[model samples]
Every structure is written in C-alpha cells, then in structure tokens.
Target: MKEGTVLIIGRPNVGKSTFLNNLIGQKVAITSPKPQTTRFPIRAVYKDQRGNIIFVDTPGVFGKAEDLLSRQINKKTLESIQEDIDLVLYMVDHTRRRDFEEAKVLGIVRKIEKPKILVINKIDKTTPSYLAQYKFLEKEFDRVHMISALKGKHIKPLIDDIFKFLPEKKGESEVDFHEKPTPILNIDSKTYVAELIREKLFLLTRDEVPYTVNVEVEEITPRSENLTYVKAKIITTADRYKKMLIGKGGKMIKEIGRLARKELELMSNKKFYLDLEVITDPHWQERIE
Candidate 1:
C-alpha cells in the first residue's frame, strides 16, 4: 500500500480546478472559465484498495503579478508546492505551447527536487500534431500524460501512474474499499459558503464586475432544527458596480442569491433564508487578511 501527497500547479486557465474535481469524483474546488478563480490551495483525499493519495490544488501561476493580491496568490502557490510533497503535477494547456509563464513555473518545480509529472490538459481542444509537439517533454519529465479533464478521457491510466510513484504504506486496511472518499482538510462552513457565493457572482456578472467583487459572509445562524439563516455582503469596487449588481428592481442580486441559495441548500441539506446586500468597497481586495 502506498500513501502520500501530490501538489498540482499550473499556469492560469490550465483546468487545474476541473482536473482536481474530476480526479476526486467530487467538487472540492470551485471552477470557472475566468482566470484567478482559485485563490488558495484546496486539499482533497483519494483512496482506493492500494492506498490513499492527498491532493492539493493551488492557485494558477501567472507571468506578471500586477497587484498585491496577485503577489500574495503567487506566494500561496509556491508555499504549498514547497511543502513535503510526494509528487508534483505540472499541468499545461495542450493547445498552447510552452511560454514565459511555463518557463517560470518550471524553474520553481526544478528547485523543489521532487518527482514530477507533466500533464497536458485540454487535449480535446487540440489535434494530434499539437500533442506531438509536446512529445519531446517525455524525456524531461518523470512521466507525461495527455488528458481531457473535462471529458474524463485517459484518466484511469493517469490514476494508475499517480499511485505507482507514491511511497508505500506499512499496514493494510480492513475497511471496505467501496467506501466513499473523504476530505482531508477541516473545511469551514462559512468559507465554502462564501466561495459558492463568489462563484455565482463570477458566473452572473460580466467583465470587471466579477473580478472586482468579493463576498463576505456576515452571519450564519441555525434558526431551527433543519433551517439556517445566512446573511452575506457583496463588496464591489465602486458605487456604479454596486448599483449594477443590484440592477433595476433588484433583478441581478435576486438571481445571484437564488442560485447561491439552491446550491447551499443541496450542500448543507437544510432550508436556508439567505439575505444578500451589496456595498461599495474599493479597497476590499487590498485589506490585510
């Protein structure tokens, strides 16, 4: 039996979040079409008859850090990968060639001195020639695999390879192998609630509205045995955005809240009374955590 941690790092919009969700067979991380959707390292567990593998999904690496927030996100990505990891999965969009960002990311991976796998994601969008272009990378990596994360193609072989490189464990488990996989991190209810709201915010709004907004869960209280009341404040960069989010007759805010409430109910298995408010806070992202 083998057991260890795998750290996944990649450039922005490389499908890191989608890959993690597909690998784990659950939605442990929130994903969107936009870049920078993931801001922190998300931890999940994958177990089988052989052993258990702890997976950490980190924020996407970008070439330029234009703001303090981007710099902080980059720091978090590096900090997670530098830990005592058993393996590193460096994913790249198969449709795109190696560029400056990929070069920079590889430099950091080299310094880690751990066994690494080069994953070419989104192969469904590319042709055989595109895949062949990266074939030379096989010699540079411990192992390389091309996969379509969104479509779940060629994943079983990848899983086999992932477990093969992990360090072996001593004991055998008596528990049933059919049992469901569990999460490794102690996930906070408020944190995920906030994240779900932010995800919906990204999907509902366009352009800078999503990027310039942040969700703050002000209160979560249990009002009854199977009922909870949640109050969240959506912070926007300007009064114009705040009003835009509110929309005429409060249409936009209502839609966002409605979708978020439905998801929260399914996740918590409880009835929820959700109250949403939008406020202008241009420096919300700049505030020290």
Candidate 2:
C-alpha cells in the first residue's frame, strides 16, 4: 500500500484548509474569509483501502507580513516545509488574480525537491476568474488538477493521482488507529476547543476584531456525565476592541458563546457550559510563540 506525508502550501484564503477538511471528511482545521485564519500547521491522518496518509495543512504565507502575527505565521509555514514531506500540493485560488502573494508562495514551492502537484481550486467560480494567468504553471508540474474543494468536485480523481506518487509501505500501519481516537494528531482537546471558539470570533466579528484577538481555554472540567464546564478568555490588544467584542449589553459575547457551545455539544455528544469573557492585553502578540 502507498503511504506517506503530504504538505499543502498556498497563499492566504486560497482554500488550503477547506481542501484538507473536505478530503479528510472532518473539521481538523478552522477556516474563515480572513487571511491567515489558520495560524499554525495542523497535522491530520487520512486512511483508505490504499494506505495511510498524513496531511499537514499549513498557515498561508503572506506577501508582506507587516504585523507580528503575520510574520510568525509565515515563519511557521516555512518551518513546516522543511520537514520530511513525501509530496507537495501547491494550491491556488482561481477566483482571485495572481499577484505578488501568489508569486511569493510559488517561489517557495519551487525550492521543494519532492514530487509536486499543482491544484487549481475554486473552479466553480467563473465570473471573476484569472484562470488564464495560472495555466502557464501546468507545464512546470507533471500533474495539474482543477477542483472545487468546497463543492468536492474532481476530488476523488485528485486523491487517486496523489497515491500514484506516494511510496509503497509493505508492513503494518505506522499510526495505531486504535490508540489514537481522532485523526488529528498535533493538538489536544483543549487546543481544539480553543480553536473552535476562535473560529466563531472570526466568523461573527468584522474587520480587525478577529485578527486582533486570541482565544485561551483556562479550564475544562466535567461537571457531570452529561455536561462539561469550559472557561475561556478572548485576549485582544486594546480596550476598545474588547468592548467591541463584548458588544452593547453583552450581545456579541453571548452570541459567540452560544454558537461555540452548540458545536462543542454536537462534537462531544454532551452539554457544555462555556464561560467566555473578553480581556485586553496589549502584548498578546508578543506571547505567540
């Protein structure tokens, strides 16, 4: 059976996370319209009749990393690429024009010596397309796929093509699926829960609010067999941003907590008491190591 590691690389909002989630049939990473929504590399495993594959969904590389967070995210993406990867999937969003950001990501992808695949994502969007600009890339790679990750179009064929490049493993599986309860390997329950809350913050908030905030889960305890108690804090850089996150009469915070709680409950098959609050810490970005 063919088994190996695959790394997905692309610029911000190019649907890298969406593609990984769809391929695995699970939400191992959080995604949003905001650039750099994925702050770190998320490692998850995918298994089928062919073999086991480990997929690393990395943070999108930025053309100009003006902020401390953006710089850190770019560094993380670079670090991920340096690891032992069996294959590389360079994805691009066709709905958006190819520019400096795309060039920056491509410059990095070109340096990888492993087998590479050029995946053109968002094929469903035809009106505002720069598909012609990316067509020239087809000659550079042996395989090119046009897929709509969100719609799951042409994904099966892409998976089949990926296996063709993978090296065969003749022995037992490397990952002990019986011991690992979830496909996600790099994060614990607390970190995953924090990410879920952060996703809500990203989806509900507007403009810079989502970018300026970080979610931290202070404590997660079982109150009873049917319920879990989770206490988390939304850390931001300024009091004004905190006030906006809290909203007038606590409307915004309440809604964010409600949506996060519902998803947590659905995932765990138990009730959750999410004690969420907003706080201001001017140096929160500095602590992002």
Candidate 3:
C-alpha cells in the first residue's frame, strides 16, 4: 500500500487550509478570509483502501514578518518544510496576482528536492483571471492540477496523482485505523475548542482585533450526560481592543459565544455552556513558545 507524508505550502489567503480540510473530509484546521488564520502546522491522517497518508497543513509564509506573531508563524512553516516529507503540494490561487509574496513562497518551494506538484486553486472564479501568469510553472513541475477546493472540484484526480507519487509500505501499517481514536494528531480537545473560539473571533471582529487576540480553554467539565461546560478566555494586546471585542453592553462577545456554541453543539452532538471572557495582555505575543 502507498503510504507517506505530503506537505501543503502556499502564501497567505491562498486557501491552503480549505484545501486540507476538504481533502481530509473534515475540519482539522481553522480558516478565515484573513491571512495567517492558521497559526501553526496541523498533522492529520488520511486513510483509504490504498494506504494511510499523513497530511501536514502549514501556516502561510509571509513576505515580511514584522510582528512577533507573524515571525513565529513564518518560522513554524519553514521548520515544517525542513522535516522528512515524501511529497510536496505547492498550492496557489490563480485568481490572485503572482507578486513578491508569491515569489517568497516559490523560492522556498524551489529548494525542496523531493517530488512536487503544482496545484492552482480557485478555478471556479473565471473573471479577473491571473491564470496566464502562473502558466509558466506548468513546465517546471511534472504534474499540475487546477482545482476549486471550496467546491470540491477535480479533487479525486488530485488524490489519484498524490497516491501515484507515494512510497509503498512493505509490512503492517504503522497506523491502525481501528485503534486510532482520532485522525488529528498534535492537538487535544481543549486546543481544538480554543481554535473554534478563535475562528469565531476572526469571523466576527474587524481590523487588527482578530490578529491581536488569542483563545484559551481553561476548563471543560461534563455536568451531565448531554451537557459539557467549558471555560475560556480571549487574550488581547490592549484595553481598547478588549473593549472592541466586548462591544457596547457586551453585544459582540455575546455574538461570538453564541456562534461558537452553535458550532460546538453541531459537531459534538451535545450541549456546551461556553464561559468566554476577554482580557488585556500587553505581552501576549511575546509569550508564544
């Protein structure tokens, strides 16, 4: 059976997270319209009759990582690339122009000696096409595929190609599907819940508030068979940002909690009482390790 690791790399807002989520047929990463929504590399397993594959979804590489958070995120992505990976999927958004940021990511991709595939995403958007600009990469890579990750278009063929390049496993599989509790590796239940809250903050907040904020799930208790109680906090850089998140009479925070709770219930098929609060932490970004 074919089995190996495939790493997905791209620039910010190119739909790398979306592609990973769709490819796994589940949400192991959080996504947003905002760039750098994915803070770190997420490892998830994908299994089928052919083989078991480990997929690493990495944070987008920034052209200029000015802030502490952006620099850390960029560092994490570059570090993931240095690991032992069997194949690489260099994903790009054809609707966007190929500029210096694209060049920055491309430069990294060019250094990799392993098998690579150029995946041009967002083919569903026809007008305002920058398709011609990325056409030159076709000759550079042996395989290229145009897909719309959001619409699940042409994904099957992409999977077929990915399997073709994977190395065959000679003995018993390292991962036993029946014994594995979850496909996602590298994160616990609390971290997953925290990410859900963070995603809501990204969707509901404006400007720099989303980037400045981080979520922490402190306590998760099962009060009953059908209900789970969760306590969480949102850490921000300043009081003004905290106020903005709280909004007038706490309208904004309430909306964020309501939306997050709805999604939690939908995914877990149980009730969740999320105790969410926002606080000011001037050095929150610096604390990231």
- Tens digit per residue, CA lDDT, model 1, 1-289: 7888899999888899899889777678888888888888998877878788888899898778787777878888988976778999988886777778878887887777888899988878855336665676778789998899999999888889999889887476322345643655436778778888888888888887887788888899999999999999999889999988999999999999999999888877889998999999889878835
Per lDDT, the best of the predicted structures is: 2
The 10-residue segment of model 1 with minimum total lDDT is 172-181
Off by over 4 Å in 2: 170-172
Q: Report the lDDT tens digits of candidate 2 across residue range 1-289.
A: 7888999999999999999888888889999888889999999998899987889999999999999999999999999999989999999999999999999999999999989999999998897989899998999886999999999999998999889888998587677788876585698888999999999999999988898999999999999999899999999999999999999999999999999999988877999999998999999999989
Instruction: Give the deviation of candidate 3 from the true structure as CA RMSD.
Output: 1.1
TM-score of each: 0.89, 0.97, 0.97
What is candidate 3's CA lDDT for residue 96?
90
Candidate 3 lDDT over residue span 20-75, tens digit each? 88888778899999989999899888878888778888999988889899999999
TM-score, candidate 3, is 0.97
Model 2, position 52, has a per-residue lDDT of 79
Cα RMSD to native, each candidate? Answer: 3.2, 1.1, 1.1
Instruction: Give model 2's clash tally.
Output: 0
Looking at candidate 2, what is the lDDT of residue 27?
Answer: 87
| Angstrom error at residue 15, model 3 | 0.9
